[model samples]
Target: MKLSEGVEAAIHCATLLAQLEEGRTMPASALAEYHGLSPSYLLKHLKTLTAARILESVSGPHGGYRLARSADAITLLDVVLAIEGPQPAFRCAEIRQRGPGALEPEVYAAPCNINAAMLRAEQAYRAELRKTRLSDVISDYLGEADPRALAFSCAFVARNQRPQG
Candidate 1:
């Protein structure tokens, strides 16, 4: 299953927001700048997350965005589903039931094996994502990242992420 660029951006931005102090918010422009993404495009995906209740959008001066719930409460699957929608990646078009090689109608008593296998794989993929959360990923990253660099990033975001004036 190929993930859209929006999914990747949403995940990264959400995890970054998870780094902020409670009640703090980062404007979409700041987040887009941080990741070198287009604010307009990124906001499209962010709206999906907000609509899913995974993130909150604050309005007015100093308005921006923050997690609607704890990072651990939000899984990678949450963000993925928000941005990618609930449609299964591999839809069973029943190709086996069509074309010149199509089997007799009565011969199709069993479920399509290929469809079953693909569905199983998709389940496994989603399960893995659901098992991981933004906080978990951040913790894992902190372990492998340079302490000074992480500190600098945190400080930078905190300093530059003031609610819009």
Candidate 2:
């Protein structure tokens, strides 16, 4: 199943926020420009993150957005659910209950095995996602990059960030 771009954007945004020092903030416009995304759309995703309490928005000349909690406290699943909502990717409509040659009472009364299997698989997928936190992913990203490259990238993001109102 394909996930929405908002999911990816929100995760990236959260990662960026995680990189900031405690009192520092990153504007949504900067995040959009860094990733070549639309500022308006990115703002929407940011709002979702704010509502999820993963990020908090600050107001005034020097205000922007900052992580509400430690990076380790936020999970990939949290960012995903913030943007996509907490709905299952797979849904069972109980197709066996429909059609002229539908299943008999004994069959219809029991939950479809197909639905059960799908649910199990979906649960496993969510469980794996839940195991991943923003800190874990960011640490992996930093570990894979050369020290100089990582420093340059961080500086680039910092330089491009705009002051928020």
Candidate 3:
């Protein structure tokens, strides 16, 4: 199943936020600039995270946003739900009884096997996402990324970030 664009933006944003030290924050505009995104568009997804309690929002000159909890406490599934809502990706339209040669009520009364299979796949996908924490993803990425580049990125973030107050 395909995830929404908001889901992708939210994941990357969370990963950046996950890199910050405890009690630190980055403004939405700063984050948008860092990723070469539009602040207005990115802020919409940021609000989704805030509404989901994955991140917290602050206002003022030095105000911004920070994780509500540790990175290890948040999972990809949490972000997915926050952006995509609780609807299943594969929606079954119950086509079994709508064809020219339609089946009887009893023949299609039981849950459709195709629908059940899709639901099962969705469950497995969610289970995998739940098993993965945001910190785990960051650690894995840092492990494979260029050390010098990673250092430079961290330095950039450190320079622009604000300490939580």
Best prediction by TM-score: 3
- Give the Å shift of residue 112 in candidate 3: 0.5
> Cα lDDT of all candidates, in order?
0.88, 0.82, 0.89
Candidate 3 residue lDDT tens string, 1-165: 788788888888888888787778899988888888989999999998999999999887768988888889999999999999989899999987897989788888789999999999999999999999999998998889998979877987898788767
Superior candidate under TM-score, 1 versus 3? 3
Model 1 stretches astray by more than 4 angstroms: 163-165
Q: Which stretches of candidate 3 lie over 4 Å from their true place?
A: none
lDDT of 1 by residue, 1-165 (tens): 699999989988988898877787889998888889999999998899999999999887778999999998999999999988998899987778899988898888889899899989999999999999888998999899998989877886888565444
Q: Estimate each model's TM-score.
A: 0.93, 0.89, 0.94
Better of 2 and 3 by TM-score: 3
Question: At residue 59, what lDDT does model 2 achieve?
Answer: 79
TM-score of 1: 0.93
Supply the global lDDT for candidate 3. 0.89
